[model samples]
Target: MRSSVILLLVGISLAFAGKHSLKYFYTSVSGDKTFTATGLVDDVQFMYFGINTKKASPKTEWVREIEESDYWKRQTHLLVEQHHWILNTIWTESAGEHTYQITYGCEWNDETGKTNAFRQYGYDGEDFLFLDLKRDEWISPVKQGFRTQERCNNETIRLVHWKNYLKMDCIETLKKLLTLGKSSLEKTVSPQVSLLQKNACSPVLCHVTHFYPSDITVTWMRNGQELKNVKVGKLLPNEDGTFQKTVTLQTEADEWRKNEFSCVVKHQSKTFRKTLTEKEIRTKNKTAAPFDVTVVVVLVAVILSLSLIIGVIGYFVYQRKLKPALSGSASKCWLSFCRISGYVTANTSPSDSENTSQSSTES
Candidate 1:
């Protein structure tokens, strides 16, 4: 049991060991000229070498003063001449301004570490570091130039200025290359849903690969709503330093029958929503009816009432002012009645007398 425990501990330790590591190594440089460089490393240390003419190390003795053109082409175990008039040194000299190449490589220490051996050189650059040829109050190369020809020896004092100049130009170029690589990789791991086998129902699998590990998220949206009970798998980086993430949701055959389901991917600050729907979502609006009919009814009643009130007022006025005229008409009617009565009585008397005369004569 104890041996087994020991073995388990060893296994755990090995498992915990990371598969990748990063290291930054910089050498001294001289002058006002600045440079920027970047490189990719796999299980290796990133290193830079500068020149110092005043100081002599085991490697510096072989470093001979050469023409500016010859300086850039010269190559050593760790440093290489990259550009013309550039002399590369793990050290720099101060007599004059010269150019040199900065080479990047991978090195491994042997088990019985005795000698140093550098592997193949993958990349080299001309503007890895800038040197101010003139002396400033901050970093004066004249004092340190005699000891080490390398100017700009005070890295801390000039770091801010040097970093700003190099980072601006170098970062842009570095980002462009990284973007191209990302694009090329995207084409390979792009999700392609295919029906592997078709029986009464077909099962589909979505494959998404070749993505940056830090900027990736996948979710399954059912219908128009996102599914809460989704099963997401772990994301692992690919061998090419990219990433692959996936989400699996086993829905009923009828659920995806019409292909109404969709997958949404979120990366960085952008949210990409994709839906497989027949129509787009829209809002509905309705207008209420107006009060025109009610208004017309009220207006008509008001006008009729107003007219009736005005007519009654006029009738009252006429009754008050024309009373004498009405009495005059009544008196004329009475006069006519009296005249008729008198005429009737006179005619009757005449008739009776005529009748008496006729009877006496006949007797």
Candidate 2:
């Protein structure tokens, strides 16, 4: 039961593992030369070569010819025959989008006779698979894949020698290509900086746009001192393959007018600064006056309306209490008046009869 539960959990975990397209790139760097070969796994389960910029033939022509070559066919057959089970299992079990990259490269040191070579596998940008140079064993993060590869000891041994041979043979071609690419590349471009204000009281934004290499620094300063309340946005890629960034400095209208706030951008060994002046703030405030007036008016109207509603409710509640008290008091007063009148009439009538009898006796 325990074993079954463990296996079930492992299966469920692996079910959500991401599927990835496989891409292999080979680079040889020797002296000033560089050579590269890139292959992508296609939908038909075969490796398709993309570009060999070193070749004289057109890229499409080379891809077409390579597909029909005996080497390509044999390699494809060997890969499918040896690893079809693992590939099929991964394809069936995994889910979502990801790409697996395999980079094989050899760098030949001019002073040293031997080459430094590596074969590494990564998912997205993180490396998780490697080949042991001495043991020729496959190191993988996937438990199942590692276990399966471990069983193929003889094949692993053969692959080690083959990879070593490839590293040695490709180093010369790579060095030449590196030199060619370096010679043709252009110098990096500097970033352009601009100041943007959304409104008078809002944060002042310093936009740095169209920079090459993507490494840049943007900072905000207030009164010649670096400000800490600076918000830097993410580095965004532009449509033209350059990068852009924005840094914002928050300040009140009075503070902005009182102190000199500046946006400083450093890119490609050049520094650019744009300052926020009192004039700009005044202009923005002037433009926003109508909007500010409208907002104030709306707020005052809402407050007045609420006050009127509250006054009406208070008056009604006062009237309700006053009416009940007045009714009770009126009933009490009427009762008191009737009692007093009855007492007075009884006393006065008795007194008058006594006075009349006394007057008749005197007569």
Candidate 3:
């Protein structure tokens, strides 16, 4: 489910610049009326809304200072309409309660004027209908979506509205949110870049983890020339909503010894370049930590894990609200991130006034 979300949305952007996206994810379960709407600035989920709660909630501290209650009210109203639309559309088509998801957003390059946007609809874990902004067409892969395609084809105005929304309004909203939360948005955690190999002959994996703002680039360069045959892994979510990614070089270990092969990573303003070398590889045979150091690390990890668990549980108790319980496998949730808090700071609106944003939303 999360991998699907990752395909639909971005890992996330802003103060550090480059590019940014404003996207929304909505899900309606078969028997659940309290569906949630997630609003993300690039990859970071900053706001959430629920049909039951009827409140647009902030997910980050910086967003709490938006000072626009009406903006949130408009967002709540828009999401509410969107929430019902997805549910009713699914129910009408399936002739029964069915779960469905909507992922819609726009991407913008801050340095350049490049912009792109999309709307993808999914039901029962498959693509149902999607808007091809470039082609200005609605694509429905499954037979179940024929009516939807036909309806969308006939509604040229809605298509135009969406085009404008994605191109203009969504981009503007993203920019505003970036400005609103620059201090928090710019906070980044440098990736822990490590070259790991299980054995001398195994695939040499450049593992990057615990990085923030998810816009890191990993390139395999041999003697400063880019290597195209490398296997690049997906950007995966972390336990704390950070990200991890892997780039694999599937060659004999001797290749790096003969050439200066480097794994270069660029994120925000920092760049990490790690050359492949035997001494740098954390091989099982030789790279194991000293016994005492290993024990100390394990003990500290255990203590920290226990402390984090207690702190999380305490947060739930004191807040008196729970959206979704945290699990040990949070890092494994690729895209549909686990909701660990009911308390969030709310922040995006349409390009124009509240009515303008809301008007485009109802479509």
Q: In model 2, state the lDDT of residue 277.
A: 68
Q: What C-alpha lDDT, on a 0 to 100 scale, does residue 264 get in candidate 2?
A: 79
RMSD of 1: 34.7
lDDT, model 3, position 71: 68
- Model 3, global lDDT: 0.77
Model 3: residues >4 Å from true position, as ranges?
A: 1-16, 31-34, 95-98, 239-241, 284-363
Of 1 and 2, the candidate ranking higher by lDDT: 2
TM-score of each: 0.23, 0.38, 0.68
lDDT of 2 by residue, 1-363 (tens): 234323333322221122212234633222222333454321111233322322322122223423224645564454444234433543345455444455755554333345555667565466656666566666776664565456544575667675765464445433332222222212356898767676656677788898864668899988789888788899887876567898887777666667788887876548888777644332333423213556779999999999999999999998888776675578677667755444333445787756655665666
Candidate 1: regions farther than 4 A off: 1-205, 269-363
Winner by TM-score: 3
For this target, which candidate reaches the highest lDDT against the unseen true structure? 3
Clashes of 2: 11
On the 0 to 100 scale, the lDDT of residue 196 in model 1 is 19
What is the Cα-based lDDT of residue 88 in candidate 3?
A: 73
On the 0 to 100 scale, the lDDT of residue 243 in model 3 is 92
Candidate lDDT values, in order: 0.39, 0.54, 0.77
Ranking by lDDT: 3, 2, 1
